[model samples]
Target chain A: MDTKLAMHTKNLNFFYGDFQALFDVSLDFGANEVTALIGPSGCGKSTLLRCLNRMNDLIPETRSEGEIYFRDQPIHGQEVDPVEVRRQVGMVFQKPNPFPKTIYENIAWGARINGYRGDMDELVETSLKKCALWDEVKEKLKQNALGLSGGQQQRLCIARTIAVEPDVILMDEPTSALDPISTAKIEDLITELRKRYTIIIVTHNMQQAGRVSEKTAFFLNGVIIEAGLTSDIFFNPKEERTEAYISGRFG
Target chain B: MSASYTGQKSYYGDGMAQNIARRRRHGRVWHILFYAATTISILALIVLLLNIFNAVFGFVLIEDEVPPTELAPGGDLESLSQGELISLLEEYLSVGLIRRFNFEEPLAERSVTDLAALVQVRIVNPTVIEAWSLQESLFQSDMIRAEHAAHPGTRVQFRSWLSARFLVSPQNPRPQLAGIRTAFFGSLWMIIIVIVVAFPIGVAAAIYLEEYARSEIWYNRIIEVNIYNLAGIPSIIFGLLGLAVFVRALEPFTSGTVFGGVDPTTANGRTIISAGLTLSLLILPIIIINSREAIKAVPSSLRESSYGLGATKWQTIWHHVLPASFDRILTGTILAISRAIGETAPLVVVGASTFITVDPKTLFSKFTTLPIQIYQWSARPQSQFRNVAAAAIVVLLVLMLSMNAVAIIMRNRISKQRRI
Candidate 1:
């Protein structure tokens, strides 16, 4: 019923075959703000992020219950198409996965396939510029994207996601595989991206959550332990388990 | 277990040095065993290639019934033009023989080589008195000449059976005039048909199995198992299947009767089309298995990213999965094609004409592939036919190697363009 919210989930439960990966979980993401999901390994942050875009549908026998909404529309409705939901809500993976194509093509392919009829060159340049990769890759836009460094390739992936101009961007550990400098660059890019799009990022680093997120949700055993202001979650949490996880007492 | 000593040796313990020496001796034995295995494989290949080459190039002593010098205007058969050679054929050969030659093809339209072969077979009637391999010809030329001196009017010449004339003339009873022109075209047409019929169907089946089919489905699992097992089935069994289906059941289509091409001379389903389809059946399972493996080798991450970008399964496969696996698919196709080209049993059962001298002008025409030609020649009673079969083997190997080389070049170019 929160019309102003960019997206919200209502009692979402997910399963990989018979084994449950997510409990009945409800969460909301504000428009043009960053929300961080912090959890230990196998705690289901990535699974939940994937569920938002129905990316989990690609895995065989994996199922999700309950509802996910984008703006006012229910994404999990029978009439709703997964492709359309994913087009509106783009995703950035944990590792850079650029298409085996030129840098320009990597940014243009998603938009082109989604029926983007704009000037492709302008779109590629703007996407790269948004990710702050234009200056570095402008001279070699026609070169293979895989030939780039890990950080640059990740930036290219981000640029590729934003090229389609989605309303929300889901990043599952966007900088988890990068070095410190590249991580800093991505954190800054997140700050810049937050001004235009709602970002829901899954991260293992609590400091990153405190640094970039307006709101933080802590996950434990496929369940949402507590969610509140990032400052409060880091400073003072309502749940003892949330505090225990935040203070690094145990996973 | 804890004892140690050191000087020149880094370390030593109770029974450790003896144990190490024994282990090293065992290692040496295994090493020599592996090395011998590799050497045997290499030596076997070298011997096979050497035998083919030795048979392909050699020397022959020939005695012409009528010397070519008397037939040629100036006793130089090589200098005579096509018209003159045809005139010579018309002048000397009987009308029945000329008509038989013309029935295969028009004499006027035939190449000079064909006219010369006719003169040799009908007029000069050259027969191989004796043949010697390159090794014999090089090492014992004097002994060979003296051994064959009893044969009157015999001329000794170095004759590489794989010559230009051998490539152009049609099959003949006389080994001196026999050529691979008919068999070459037959093989070419058969291979083209195989590629056209097999590549697309095989790749599509592979894509379906790799991308769409569910492992949990009963029929899919059965199909998967069948494909793998089909790859190991004896090719002769495929020939029997082809004989039953392509040669008999689909006789009308295979014989070109459905297309209104009815030839009274050899009106049967043992045509190029039937043989091609038969060979296609023999290699289809192999192509499918290889293509599926290629499709499977594409990284899961690339596919995941495509799906995450909202690409439909087909769109993702068309744009990403197929391109990433292009090189491997081509490699598999090349392997399948090489196997098909050298396939003999299926075509033999599909009824390749052993004495087929006419070039296959259409798919419905009588056909014989290179391997079939080799089989036919080697099985003949004549010693010269067996030697020429060696030459045919050389041709087959060259064709296979060249095709593989072209495919490898294409695969390299594509893989360089996309290394995913």
Candidate 2:
């Protein structure tokens, strides 16, 4: 494993008003590596993913305790702007939510707003190519993004996120709504993206976690049950609950 | 026991057939009821359209004091220049009437079109003694001819009350000469001001309430409830409010005195600007409620995605939320404007002039709207005025529908651009 740390959270606790959603949890993400957070429903995996770039701040009355460090700088500190954090750490949602704009504009909007002054046409093309969508969409760059198929739209979302040139990308169940073929394509894309970007994915599918990630963190009841190399977590027994969840005794 | 049960089932088979027959009969009854309701609604719309069309096209016995040919000696009345029309008016009309008209609006400065209309109205003085609906005019020509013959001095002519001249000429005491020009311009000015004043304020208020205001706050709840209640309040109440707030309190600003006066004598608060501001208040709640619904219709996921991409709240709303809901917001605006266009009670209470000959020259000019004009005409004792009033109603309907159609087309174009 690479020793370079991309991000880490220490003793992170999250609450929606008075209801606690995440307990004291500590996690580390390595640079240029894929880390998968796997758990059942309502285990705070998505909550933890949203905390990386402060996406949870949008919800009213949501508060977080402790600290999240991106490249060893405290992101949740008073002086830090969530907008700046989100610029460097982009995200892909569970469902493919493309802006109701042209395919070219959808990729260009985030980059343009984030102060990207380079050749926009080249940026759109490269981002699409990175998501393996350039050939299918290059002819109709001016068409509405919503016109794409489910898998194509998801890929376009990835293209849109990476267009801003972010260092880390957080994906919250990016393929849970997709079919088998689209899921496979996205998993392959994720592996390819790991070369240059730190990718953290929160997925419910166990086999997907084992297949795509180098490190796997198992979550149960708003707490981290186990965290280790994906191979070790899938094969070796460190926590009984992790084994029980993996072997399908219970979720 | 099993054999006895089988015997009983066979005995009730005839009864079961009877129940099935009754159920089928009830289903047919409900289907007929549904169809009848649809037919009644469509028939009502058709009847309304036919009624308006009946008044628009008709036959009238017109008794001209002086023929159009006699009025315009050298050239056709339609082709005469403003100077020629002015000379013709002076030659035909008595000096006292001409002086009175000149006092109101200097004929020398009026456009050729306005001069021609003045010549037709003041000099020719055509009187419609008798009028018939489109049906009677089309099918009972002999009856109309006999009626005109009995009148002796009148000639039966097929006249469409809704003429191109009817749209351009100003209101007159005579039904044959009255037109909706002044009221049309008044409505135009009022609607322009209403939309300008209400749209941005309404949309901003809606955005704040829907997106920024915390639902848990007591004041937000009160505001939300008040907005809903305001939308349902009778339009007449808005009229009273406009009268008190805009016409009375804000007289100086609305009358344009504070901004340097245009017409001092008539530029009281009872002007087009006051009427426009009043109507803005009238439609503000509607615009806010509808725009809130439009903003709410935007999926939450879109907002989340925007936020996740590092976009600020304003940027997300401007780039995604507003665009996504643009078509619906336009629909709401069109509806609100249409309501404002037809509104009469508020304008009446706010002091819309019953008779105004000159077109509104500025916001401070005293004004009348189509509904107010129609209302005044319909209130007159003459039957001919009622026919003219019906014709004005047709004009109003057409204007409202055309405005709505333009908005709908714009909305469709925007939606098509965003179509998936």
Candidate 3:
């Protein structure tokens, strides 16, 4: 594995109010590669993904201990603006949340906020094309995003996230709500995404983890049990618990 | 095994069917109760509306002389036209009841009821003018000319009950003629001033509370709670506050040379600005509460999506939240204004006059609203004045009803647009 790290976490812990969620855990994501975090519900996989850009700060009760770094720069440092961090590490939520605005404006909102005064039309078109949603939505760019189907909305969200030209894209169960065909389309988009930017996805489907990701980390009870190349994690697991889970013994 | 067999038989047989039938009977009883409750509420509303209609459209009675040959014992003048009534009044009534009314004094200043009492006395006692008309009729014996010569005073002076001319003309000190033109104009000015001062401030406060304020401090919480409580406070209390604040404290600024040097206090104790401010305070809470509800009704997902695209908080609220909520805010403002228009207690507490002869031309000028005018005329002891009061009440009700109807139409338009 070429372990040139894109993002690294060191002894990170998180809490929602008084209840601690993520225990002391460390992980590394490689540059230009897809990293998948697989865990059951409430195992802190999404929490860990959110910590990358400090999106968890939006929650009033959420608190964290230890440190996170992007390209060796501490993301949680007081001097670092969360807005700037979020700009660089964009996120796509599990549920498709499209703005009640025009499709074109939805993509342009990010660029405009970051003071991108250049070719807005070109940028919107390019971003939509990158998400593989251009042809489907091209003719009605001025129409409301709500008019799109769920699959189309999800893809539009992805396009909106990438429009800001973020260095890293963090997706939380990106295809969990999609139909099979949309899921396949997203899997293809994710493969294409890794060629230009670092990708981190949290998902439950083992096949998705195997298909799109180069590296896999399996979390259980807020602890990372095993992580290695995707093939090794799936086909020839190191831990007995990993084997039991992969074989469907129990979550 | 025997118990299980018994249970299975009950579940599979007529016993279960009987239980289902009993439940269905209970459901029917509930449905009947729900429908009965609905019908009772609607029936009550209909009864109240009927009461309002009865009070507004009741008959107007005017007294006149009935020719002895055509006279019924208790005569109502419903059958007489303008020409016949003029001839009859000229026959019996004298100048004592036939004096012309000025039609320019404030209805409050002149006691129309007392004047009506005086007319009733003259109706019973014929003056010299009546005797002269009767003698002139006996000599002429040309029936039409005799009728005219007999009641010459009535031909020149009698105003049939409350006519449309009374509404179109200004109120008079004379017992025969008075109208509500000045009072209507005063209310128009008050409403205009209230809308001008209240809308921007109310909407701005709502926007700040709903969109701008970030800290969850106890002070902001208290402000929120106080605003809600203010919405429920009595309008009369706000009138007292406005009297103290706008009339007394801010008197110099409001009633100074800019207001044409009119004293902050009038004989009636109400200025246009004072009445307007009182009404504004009365409706401010309503406007704020409605606007907040409108802003809050905008979907949370819309805001989240805007933020997810790196839009700032202001940008998200401005570009998406406000536009989505604008129609609702406009509808709410119309409702608030309509409520302000119908309020009588606060205007009364502020001492608005029922008898202002001049139309209000400035915010600081003295004014009278419609309800006050109606109240003044209704209090008069004269039966004719009562008819005039009923007519005024109809006008006031029509104005308020039209405003409320406009509010409903605006709300409907907003809802229709929102549906798509």
Candidate 3 lDDT, tens digit per residue, B1-420?
A: 323454663335546658789999999999999999999999998875554444333222222442222422343233434444444444556644444422344323445343333333334322212211222233534553455555543332222333576566677553346687877787677778778978888888899998876436678889999999999998889988987887767766556545445643442235787888889888888889999999989977676556655666778778878878877887888788878877788888777876667777766677787778877777776544554566576677667678778777877775554442
Please identify which of the two predictions, 1 or 2, would achieve the higher TM-score against the true structure. 1
Model 1 stretches with alpha carbons more than 4 Å out = A1-3, B1-30, B68-75, B78-122, B264-266
lDDT of 1 by residue, B273-363 (tens): 9889888888899889999999999988899888777788999999999999989999999999999999888888889988978999988
Q: What is the lDDT of residue B134 in candidate 2?
A: 93
Where model 3 places Cα greater than 4 Å from the true spot, the runs are A1-3, A239-251, B1-14, B62-197, B211-216, B256-269, B383-420
Give the C-alpha miss distance for residue B39 in model 1, angstroms.
1.5
- The first chain of model 2 has a TM-score of 0.98
Q: For model 3, report the TM-score of its A chain.
A: 0.98
Model 2 steric clash pairs: none
lDDT per residue as tens, model 2, A91-193: 9999999988899999999988888999999999999999999999999999988899889999999999999988999999999899999999999999999
lDDT for each residue of candidate 1 in A3-101, tens digit (9 for 90 to 100): 258998999999998999999999999998899999889999999999999899888888989989899799988899899888889999998899999
Question: What's the TM for model 2?
Answer: 0.89
> How well is each residue in A6-71 modelled by candidate 3, as lDDT tens digits?
899999999998888889889999999999999788888999998888878766667999989999
The pairs that clash in candidate 3 are B90-B151, B91-B151, B103-B172, B171-B179
Better of 1 and 3 by lDDT: 1
User: Highest TM-score, which number?
Assistant: 1
